[model samples]
Target: MLSRVANNLIWMNRYMERGYSVLNLLKVNYSAHQDSPDLFPWTPIINNYCGSDSGFSSENSIECINHMIFNLDNQNSIINLVTRSRENARSVQEHIPRELWLGINSYYLYLTKPELPNKLYQEDPVVFLDRLLNHQLLYYGKIDITQERGSAYYFMDIGKFLERVIQISDLASMKLKEIAKTSDALERSFLWKNFLLSIGAYQLYLKKYKSTFQEDFIIKLIFQEQLFPKSLYYCVNKLSRHINQLIQTNELVNNDLEFLLGKLQSTIQYTTIESINEQGLTNFIASIKNDITNISLSINNVYFSNQS
Candidate 1:
């Protein structure tokens, strides 16, 4: 329950979650364009997300892969994310299970290899990204069976969902903006499905619902589907539960954290697709982004800010 441990847990998961999401973005764009122009959409997106434009403008897909996979300048790069996540895992090694700690260390070691950039560039970057994502997903799968289901687990869960919710929201926002400007219906349809696919929700969506692709359907699926783990609703619900667990375990008396998450989750739960259509996707997604930021700040204030 120490602030240091909590901070490390949140950050370790944040970096890893963001790393996986970025890899997903790379996979989506590279898979779409690898055969023809070799250029990828991630350079601009990464440059925008990381707020640094030093090497992104001229970098082709392969060069951008080098920067994203191994560059030290980009803090959001996989190597740095793995490095920082592993460092935080090291800090809490004794608290978490050996399997989880070893997993983090092994991932870091894999990224630190000298041949990674060459392999990423030469051997189908999307394949490499997919493999890395599977490895990361495998690593996360070990947590539930191995790690203790106490405050530590709750802390890590909060970290994972918090980062995930934000990433999906941002990507969804980007896709919505792109979709809004498209003149062709076919392109809009593709963009709508692409948005779902980016977050790993496409197949489940296809199997579950038989609706034709529309912006509202995709947005509703991403935001309203409680069954989909990657959806905004699911993430928020999971986050609120973890927060409740933390409250019970620590006997913390913070009410604002509960209130903030409660309001957000309730809005997601009660609002129907009709209401979301009326409110507008851009506005709805933007408000959720703001609420998540506020919740994160509130968490810091309540649990970590005052710890000495």
Candidate 2:
């Protein structure tokens, strides 16, 4: 596969994953706000998703929803995510299945409807977000059914798990920040529940833990649990497997890339939740973020580099 095509595929799926994640975050936060307007604030979300550098801040839930969902000027908005993902798909139409292209194109069209903003504003916001989130799920289903197991598919998975790691880390960071602001157990519980709900892990959490939410157990669940699809360990482990497949097929061969991934996987896989707490959650998350950023840079230089 051409490096350009591989790059496009990686970014295409990254955008898709990011858009899906943002929708869930918006839905969860919106519902949380309804439950306790005083406890849930949009500032952290705005700063996290809107890009702190964008200088966009809104306390009003409705206005934030408008900016996040519809404002094209906000580069991270759902509209832009769909637009960019579709554009990427359009560029690599021959490299992807027709159904996959249609799924993304349909997603773009849905977001383009001028009434979407109104639907969120006037109608139930959760329903509005769910419609879009379900579209994302359908999009993933199409990929699984249509895309063959090859370099193209591997690259898409790489993009997806990479984006998932970043999103989960960011969510953890935001929730931990909020938890730090208050010592009240009720507020802490709400923050943890909000975090899990935002990531679609609440049900699994309840089933697995089947008990009260403790900080250690919640941390273990999100960061280390192997069965949980969204856990950092699972995502990182999947990412390693996909990248290894690419390397085994000789589609990608970079010692630095392999070494970085190995180090990252071991860093997560070998550490205990007890050690993580001792090291401090903020610092641990920061290290993971830094490692992911480096690994991404390495992947770009190794496989997607113009020189390659």
**Best prediction by lDDT:** 2
lDDT of each: 0.79, 0.87
lDDT of 1 by residue, 177-255 (tens): 6666768787776767767778898898788777768666676778889889898899999999988877877734465
TM-score for each predicted model, relative to the true structure: 0.93, 0.96
Superposition error at 239 for model 2 (Å): 1.0
Q: Which ranges in model 2 have alpha carbons more than 4 Å from their true place?
A: 53-55, 305-308
Give me the overall lDDT of model 2. Answer: 0.87
Encode model 2's per-residue lDDT on 1-308: one tens digit a residue.
78888888988999889988998998889888988877899888888876778777777888888899888888889898888888889999998999999989888888898777777778877788889999999999999999998889999999899899999999899999999999999898999999999998999999988987798888888888998989989998888899888888888776587788888888888888878989999999999999998888888876675210
Q: Runs in model 1 with CA error above 4 Å? A: 35-40, 52-55, 305-308
- The TM-score measured for candidate 1 stands at 0.93
lDDT of 1 at 136: 85
lDDT of 2 at 214: 91
